[model samples]
Target chain A: MRASSRTPLTTRLWAFGVWSVVIFFVLNLLGLIGSVVTSSFATRWLGTWFPAGFTWKWYFAAWDEFQLGDVLWVTFEVVGWVVVISGLLGVPAAYALARREFPGKRFVVLLLLLPLLVPSVTYGIPLATVLYKVGFGGSLVGVILANLVPTVPFVVLVMIPFIEQIDPRIESAARVFGANTFKVFVYVLVPILMPGVLAALLLVLVRTIAMFELTFLVAGPGSQTLVVALYYAVFAAGVRAVQSIDAMAVVYMVTTLIWLIIALRFVNPTQIVARAKRDTSH
Target chain B: MTDRGPTLTQRLRARGLDGVTLLVLPCVLAIIALFIYPFLYGLWLSFQPKDGTTMGNYDRFFREPFLYKTIWTTLKISIPVTILNLLLAVPIAFRVRLMKHQRLLTTILVLPITLGTVLVAEGMLFYFGPQGWFSRTVMALGLMDHAPSITHGYWGVFLSLLITGFPFTFLLTLSYVTGIEPALEQAAATLGAGPAARFREIFLPLLLPGLAITFCLSFVQAYSVLPSAILVGDPANTTRVISIAAYQAAFEDYDYSLASAIAMIMGAVQLVVVAAILGARTLVYRGPVAAAKG
Candidate 1:
C-alpha cells in the first residue's frame, strides 16, 4: 500500500459504510415515493423524471365512490378498542409482573410473549369456527378481542422495561403515609409509568391501524379495513376502478408517521424492567 | 387514633391473592384456550378424518405434485425473502446504532408498520405496475421498446415483499442491534482488531440471541403472509404459498378437514422452523467461548 494512501482503512470504511447507507435510503425514498406520487397524478403515465401531466380525477372519483370517510371512522373504532383494551389489561399486568415476587413469573412472562409466534393463518380457520359457535363470529367486538391477542403482548413487552425504573420505595412511602393499594397505584406508580404507558399506547394504536392480516382473516367483508379495502379495489376491479384506495393509503401512511413521531419522543425505550432483582430493605 | 398498616404476612397474603389470580389468569387462559387449544385441535384435525383417522390428506399432499409444490414453493419464497430482509435490515440497523439522529431514521423506517399488508400490496400496484411508475419511467427514458410489465408473478411478489417485509425484519433486528453495547466493539478495536475482526468477534457474538430472534420472527411473519400472496402473486406461476392453498381449500373447496390439515402442516412448519433456529442458536453458543461468555 502506498504510504500516501494511508487515510486509515477505518475512516474509509466508516465513510463507505454509514454515509453510503444514508444515501441509499435517500435514493430509495426518492424513487419509491416519487413513483407513487407521479403515478397518482399522471393523466398519461410516462415520465423521465416527472409525470407528463397532472390530474386529481382519480382522487376525487375515489372519494365520491368508495366512502373513505366511513372507512376512516371504522378504522378509528377498531384502533380505539385495540389501544384501550390492551392498555387497561396490559399495564396492570406489566406492573404486577414488575413488582411481584412470584414462583412462575418467568414462565408467565414467556407465556405472554408466545402468542407472537403463532402465525395469523394458524388461528384463522379455528377462530372462525369457534367464534361462530360462540355467536360473536362477526361482531366488531369479536375483531377487537382477536386483535388484543397481539396488542397486549406488544404493550406488556414495552411496559415491563419502563415500569422497572420506578423505585419501590416511592410506593412503600405512599403506603406508609396512609395510602391504600389502589390509591398508591393511582397516585404514585401511574404517574411515573406515564411515559412508558404512552409509548405502549401509541405502539398498539399505530400497529392496530395497520393490522391487516389478522383482521382480514377474521372479519366479514362489510367490516373491511382500509388495507383490506385497498386490496379488494386493486384485485376485484383492476387498479383503475377504485381510485379511492390511493387516498386511503395516503391517510394510513400519514397516521402511522404521526404515531411513530410520538413514540420517538421517549428516550431509552427498553427500561420498563430487565432483571427483577428485588430490593429487600424496601 | 393512629391506624397501623397490615401485619407483614397479612400484607403479603393480600398482595398474592390480588396480584396472581386477577392479574395473570385472564392472559394465561386466553392464550391456553385460544392459542394452545387451537394448536392441539388443529393437529388432531390434521390427522383425523371427517369420517376417521387417515393419512389420506397427508398422502394427497405428497402424492400430488401441485400440493407438494406448495411446500417447496413456500420455502423458496419465504427463505430468500427472510434472508434478504435480514440482510437489508442489518446494515440499516448498524447505521442506526452508529449515527446521530438514529432515532429519527428508525422512526421513519418503522413508519411502514402503520400500513397493513393490504395497503402495501395496493401501494405496489401503484408503484410497480406496468403503467404505474417504473415501467412508465423506463418507457420515458427510452430504455425499453414497450412498457415493461413487472407485476403479476415472481418479481412482483418479490418486490412487494422487499418493500413490506424489509421493515418488519429491520425493526425486530433494531431492537437487538441497538441493545448491543458499543464499549465491547471499542475494546476490540483498541486491541488491534480491524473493522471486520471487531464485527466477527465482538459485534456478532453479542447479537447472537437478537439475530436468532429476528430470523425466527421474520420467518414466522413471512410464512403467515396472506394478503399480498392473494393480491399480487399470480397463481399460474408467480406464487402459491401454503397459506394460499389452505385458504383456497377451506373457502373455495369447502373441505374443512383438508384445509385444517394444510393449516396444521403449515403451523407445524412454522414452529419447527423457529425451534430449529433456536436450536441452531444454542449450538452456535456452545461452539464458541466468545458467545457463551458474551
Candidate 2:
C-alpha cells in the first residue's frame, strides 16, 4: 500500500527495468511464433521482411504428407485415456492423503514425488524397455502407461490442495445418513469437488499433450502423438517443404493453446508455487 | 437385538486403514508398477552389459570421450540457462506480483510452455535463423553488416531453453514472491527500511528456499534437452546432452543396456545437483512464513 505510493526513484527505476525485460521477452516470443505462422502461409519465404506470397496450401500439404489425421486421432486417444485414468487414480488418492492420518503417509507422499522429480528421459528409457519386455512397448497401451507415470502423480499433487480446502464434516454428514464411502464420494464429494477435478484433469490433458520425452520413448509409428509427430517432421526437415513443417508447428501450437486457455480458466498458475512450497516443507 | 461382530470396515479402521485410505492404493500401485519398477529395472540393466562384465556398460560410457563429455555439455548449457532464467524470473515475478494484470501477463508468458519445445525449436529455426526475421531486421537497421547464425549451435539451444524455461521459473518465483505477507514489507517500510533493505533483510531470505526448489526444477528440465538440442543445435557436438547420448545408444545402436547405463548416469547427476541445492536450502531461514491467501 504505502510501498505502492513510493517516492523512491530507485524502486521506480527497478520496476521500469523489470517491465522492460518482460515486454521484450514477450515481444520476441510472439515474433518467433508469428514468423512460423507467417511462413506456414507463405508461398516462398526467403531472405526478406515478408514472404514472396501467401497461400493456404501448406495446411493441406502438411495434413496429407504427415498423415496428420491418424496422428491427431492417436493424440486425442492418448490424452483422453491419460486424463481419465489419472483423474480416477489421483482424485481418490488425494482425498485419502488430505483427510487421513495413516501410517506410511510420508512414504506415499515421497513415492508420488519421485516420479515428478525424476526427469522423464531417465525413467522413460527403462520404462520403455520394461514395456517392450511385457509386450506393451511401441503400442498405444505403452504410451498411455508411460505417460500415466507422471500424470497420475501430478493429478494427486494438484488435487491434494483442493481436497484439503473442503470440510470433512460434509462427508461425515453423508456417512451418518447411511451413505457408504463410494456413494458419498459419488454424490456428495464429487459435486463439491467438480471444479477442482475439472481443473486437475484439464491440466493433465494439457501436460499429456505437450509431454514429449516419455511419449517419444514409448510411442510406436501408430502411437505417435502430435508433439512426437512434429518432432519427426522437424527431424526429417529436408524431405518436406518448410511451409508444411511450419504449418504443422502452427497446428500443434493451436491445439495446445486451445487447451491451455481452457485450463488457465480453471486453474491459477500461482497455485503451482503454493504446491511446490508445500512439497518442500514436507 | 443380537449384537453383530465388528464389521470389515470397522476392523480395517482399527488399523488406520479404511475404505478412504484404500483409495490411495490404485495410484500407489500404478506408480510402483510403472515408475519404481522400471527405475529398479534400469538400475539393474545398467550393470548387465551385452558381452562384457557387469560394469561394462558404465565402463564403456566413461571410457569414450564422446559419451562422457555429454555430461559436461549438458551441465554447461543447463547450469547457465537455469541460473540465467532464475535471475531473470525473480525480478520479473516480483514486478508482476504488484501489477493489476497479473493473470494476463502470466497467461501470455505461459504460451511457450504449451507450444512445446518442438514448436519452439521450429519457430527458432525461422525467427533466429541466418535469413530469418531477426537477422534481416538487424541488418536492415545497420545493427550489423552480416547476418548472425543464432540457430544450429549452442546459442540456439540456450535461447530456446531460456524461452521455454523462463515461464516456469517466473510462475514459481511469482507465487513465492506473492506468498510473502505484504504487511511485513509495509511494516519494514514503516520502520525506515528502504526497498533494498526490506528485500535484502525480509524477502530474500524467504525467497531463497523457494528459489532453490525452482532452480532444481528448471535445471532438471533444461538438463534433459533432447528435442531442442537436436532440432536447433549441432546435436553431434555442441549440444550433445546426456539424454541424446542415451537416445542414440538405445535407438541408433539398439543397445538397451548401454542406454540404460547412460540414463542412470544422467539420473545420478541430476539427483546429486538437486540434493545439493535442497540440502543448501535447509541452511537458510526455516521458520514459519505466512502464505498469502489466493
Task: Please give the DockQ score of every candidate, comma-separated.
Answer: 0.40, 0.65
- B173-282 per-residue lDDT for model 1 (tens digits): 76666556567778887898987788788778677887888888778877877777777777654588888888888778867677778887787788888888999989
lDDT of 1 by residue, A10-100 (tens): 7677667856865665455446555555555656654345556788886777766667777667778888878987888788887877777
Candidate whose TM-score is highest:
2
Clashes of each: 9, 0
The reply for model 1, stretches above 4 Å from the true place, is A1-6, A9-22, A42-57, A239-242, A266-282, B1-21, B136-149, B287-294
* Model 2 misplaced stretches (Cα beyond 4 Å): A1-6, A271-282, B1-15, B290-294
Tell me which residue pairs clash in candidate 1.
A160-A272, A160-A273, A161-A271, A161-A272, A161-A273, A162-A271, A162-A272, A163-A272, A164-A272
Model 2 scores a TM of 0.95
Winner by lDDT:
2
Look at candidate 2 and tell me the lDDT of residue B284.
Answer: 68
Under CAPRI classification, how is model 1 graded? acceptable
Error of 1 at B178 (Å): 3.0
Q: Residues B127-234, candidate 2, lDDT per residue (tens digit)?
A: 988878888888989999999989999999999999999998898888778777789889898999987899899888878877898999899889988999999999
Give the per-prediction TM-score of chain B.
Answer: 0.86, 0.94
